[model samples]
Target: MGQTSTSLCCIFICFMLAQTVFQVESANILFFFGVSSYSHRLPAWPLVTGLAEKGHNVTFLSPFKAKNPHPKVVDYAPRKFSEWAESWDEMNMFDMRKKGDMYKQWLILPYFGIAMCEKLYSDEEFINWVKSSTYDLVFIDALFNECGYGMAHIFGAKVIQFDTTTVFPWYSSAFGSPDETNWIPDMAYVFGANEVTFQNRLINALIPVGWDLFRSWIYFPQLEEITRTGLSTTDLPTFQDIEKNVSMIFLNTYYSEEFARALPPNMVSIGGIAYVEKRTPLPKDLAAFLEKGNGFIYVSFGTVADLQKMDASTQQAIIGALQSFPELQFVWKLRNDSLLKEFPNGNVYISNWMPQQDILSHPKIKAFITHSGLIGIQESIYNAVPLISFPIFAEQDYNAERVHRNEYGIRLEITTVNQAELEDAISKVVNDSKYDPDFKFTQYSTNDA
Candidate 1:
C-alpha cells in the first residue's frame, strides 16, 4: 500500500486535528457494526463498556445488544439488520455445515462482503442513522465489513478497526505492520513450532506473501466497488487510499503471546480485557450435581457448534465413552437441556447454559473436552484446565493445534471419531499422568517462548 499523497496527508492532518480537539472536549465514539457473530462481539464489550464507564460518549449503531449497558453508551436499533441476521443465523445453524469444506472461499468472499455492505447501506434506518450522526472516532468491526471504513470517512471521523482475533498479515499490511512471518506463522493456518524447522520456517515465511497477493488481487477489487458505491458522489481518493489512514487496529489476542510478530504501532491487543474480575457463581443444581461425583470431565463445543447436529454414531460413541466410567462423572454443555435424555447415561449430565469459567475454577473439574473455540481456549488456559481439543472447522482447527502444540492438551479428529477413540482419549487424559499436573503450563509464556 502506498502512502496518501501530500494533499491527502494535509486533509488527514486537518481531520486528525479537528478530531483531537473534539476528543479533548468530550470523547465521542461511534461503533458501526452488524451481528457478525456472538464470539466476535464478546471480546469487544470490555473496551466499549469500559470507555462508557470512564465517561466517553459511546454510540453502538446495531442491534446485537449488550448486557447491563452503561448510561454513557447509546445503542441504536436496526430492525432490518436484525431480520437479516435472524434468517442468516438460522440457515447456518441448522444447515449441514458446508463452510468448513469450502477451501475455495476466495471466489465468494469478495462478493459476499460487498453484498453485506450493500445491504447495510440500503437499510434506510441505518443510512439515516449514519447521516444524522457524527463522532470523534469510529470503531468498526472489520471482518467483511470494510465498508465501515468508507462510512468513517463520510462522517469525517478517525477510523479505528476493532477486531476480536489475532492480528494478521493482511491487516498488518494496511498499517505498515511488518510481515514478520519467519517466527510468526499465520494465525488462520499456523505452520507452528516447538522449534521452527527449516521447511516449516520457509513455508511459513512464503505463505503470507502469497496470501497478501491473493487478497489484494481478489478481495480489494470488490471492496473498491462497494466503497465507491457507498460514497455516492463524494470526490475523494479510492477506499484503498482511505484505508491506510486508519488511526489504529485493536486485536483480541495478546501480541507477546502471538509467537513474535511485529505489528504496526497502531495495532493494539486487548485480548480477554473484557473478562470481569469476579466470576458468577455456578448454579446450585450444577454445583450439587458436580459434587455428587468425585470429579467430572466437562464437554462443550462452544455456542457456534450445535451438539444436536452431531451424527448419531458420534453421539453413541460419546455416550459409550461416558458410560464405561460410571464412577467418573461427565457434564456436557449443549444448546438445549432436552438433549440430556438422548444420552441416557447415569453419569452424564447436560445443560443449555453453564457458568463455564466458574465451573472450571472448581478443583474437582479435572479436564475440559472442547471444540477449541478461541474464547473457550482462553478460558481453559486462564483457569489452568487441561483440554481435549476436538475441532470442527476453521479457527477451531487452528486453535486445536495451538492447544496441543502448547502441551495444554491433546487433539482428536472428529471426522473419523469412534467409540474406542473417544474411550481412549478420555481415559488417557483422565488417567495418564500427562494431564495430572496440567502440562507444566507456565513453561510456555512470553518470557520463556
Candidate 2:
C-alpha cells in the first residue's frame, strides 16, 4: 500500500512540471506601434486582442488608448506636441481642400516628418518604455515613420509592417512588382483611365526624391541630435527593405476588394481584421434610435474629420439633403451637440459617439457616407454597404479613388460638395443595382481569398 501511494505522488509531481513547461513555452511578448491617430490604432487592436486571448503578453507603444484594454497589455504613456506644433485637434480633412496641392505638399509633408520626430524624441517616457521591455516580435504601422521601425531595429526583434493605405510603390514591391507602376491595380483597368500618364509618372517619381531630400537635409539631422541616436536622415529604410526584413506585411485590405496582385511569401492580406467582433452590442440609446428607423444611411467622416470644421452652410445643406430623403433615415455622427440640435427632426438621429461597427452591421443600414479612412472602408466592405466617399487627407484620397474605380461608390470632393451633388451621389449609390452586386462580389472575394 505504501509503495503504491508513493508512485501516485511521483506521477502527480511529474504532471505539474509538464504543465509548467507547456505554459512557459506558449508564452510570448508582442510589441505594437501606433501613432496618435485613431485609424492607426484600429487595425492593431484585433491582433493585440487575439494575442492576449491566446495567453501572450502584448506591449502596445502608442500615444492613444487601446480599443479593448487587456490585462496583458503594457500601454506606454501618451506624448505631448510642441507649443508651435499643431495638435491632432488642429488637423482636419478640409485643410487639404482649403490649402490646395502646393500647400499640402509643402506644409503637410514636413508636418509628418516633424510629428514623427516629436513622438520619438520628445517622448522620453516612450523611449524608456521600449528600452525596458523585451519583445519576441514587433508589429508597426507603416506611417509610424520614425518610431515603430526604429524601435524594432533597436530591440533586434522580428518586425511586421502593417499598411493602412492602398497600394503604393513600396507596398507593390512586396507582392513581387519589380518596379512601381502608376497603375491603380484593381479598378484602374476597369475605369479605362488607369495606368500612369507620363506626367503623373514623372511627378510620382519626383515626390519620393524630394521627400528623401527633405528628410535627409532637414528632418533627420535635427531628429538625430534630439534623440541622441545615430539614426541619420538617410538611415530611413525604403518600404521594400522594411517589408523584406519583417516577418510579414499585413494590409488592412482584402484581395477581392483590391486590385488582385501577386505578393511575396511574407506579405499577407488580412483585411477586415477590425470587424472580428461577432456582433458587439450597440449603446442602448443609439440601438433604440436605429431600431425605430425603417432603414438608415450612416454618415460619418471618421474620428479625425470634425463636422464643425465644415462650413455651417455645408452642414445645413447636408441636413436638408437627409431630410428630403424621409423614407431613408439618417444616423449622422456629428461631434458637436449644436450641429445635432440644428437637425431636430426625428428622422435624423445625432450621437456624439455611436457604435460604428454595430451600426454598419445592422441590416437596416443601406449606405455609408465616409471619409475613406482605411478602417471605415474595410468596415463598409465587411458590412457590404454601398459607399459615398468624401476623402479628406492622407491615404483617404487613395481609398476614395479606389472605391469610385471599383464601381462600389461615388467619390465626392469635400471642398466642392453641395446639397445637389450630395443628394445625387446618395441616389446613385442607393438606386444602382450594379453597386451592390459589385460590392457583394468584392466582399465575397476578399473573404474567400
lDDT of 2 at 214: 63
Residue-by-residue lDDT tens digits, candidate 1, 17-76: 887674445687988665365566667766777788878888886546655566777877
Question: Can you give the TM-score per candidate against the true fold?
Answer: 0.82, 0.83
Model 1, 282: alpha-carbon shift in Å? 2.2
lDDT of 2 by residue, 1-449 (tens): 99999999999999998877753444445545434465677766778778877777777755565555777777654545332233667765575566665236334644565566655565665566656766767876665354455556556678877766544443433345433445442211112345557766666655444545665567655544544453333455543354467777677777776665666676677887777678878888778887887888999987778878887677767777786787888888877656555555667777777778888889988899998887888888877988999877666766787788888788887876788888988898888787887688777765553
Cα lDDT computed for each candidate against the true fold: 0.69, 0.67
Deviation in Å, model 2, residue 415 alpha carbon: 0.9
Give me the candidate number with maximum lDDT. Answer: 1
Model 2 poorest ten-residue lDDT run: 183-192
Best-performing candidate as measured by TM-score: 2
Candidate 2: which stretches are off by over 4 Å?
Answer: 1-36, 79-86, 102-110, 170-177, 185-196, 205-222, 229-244
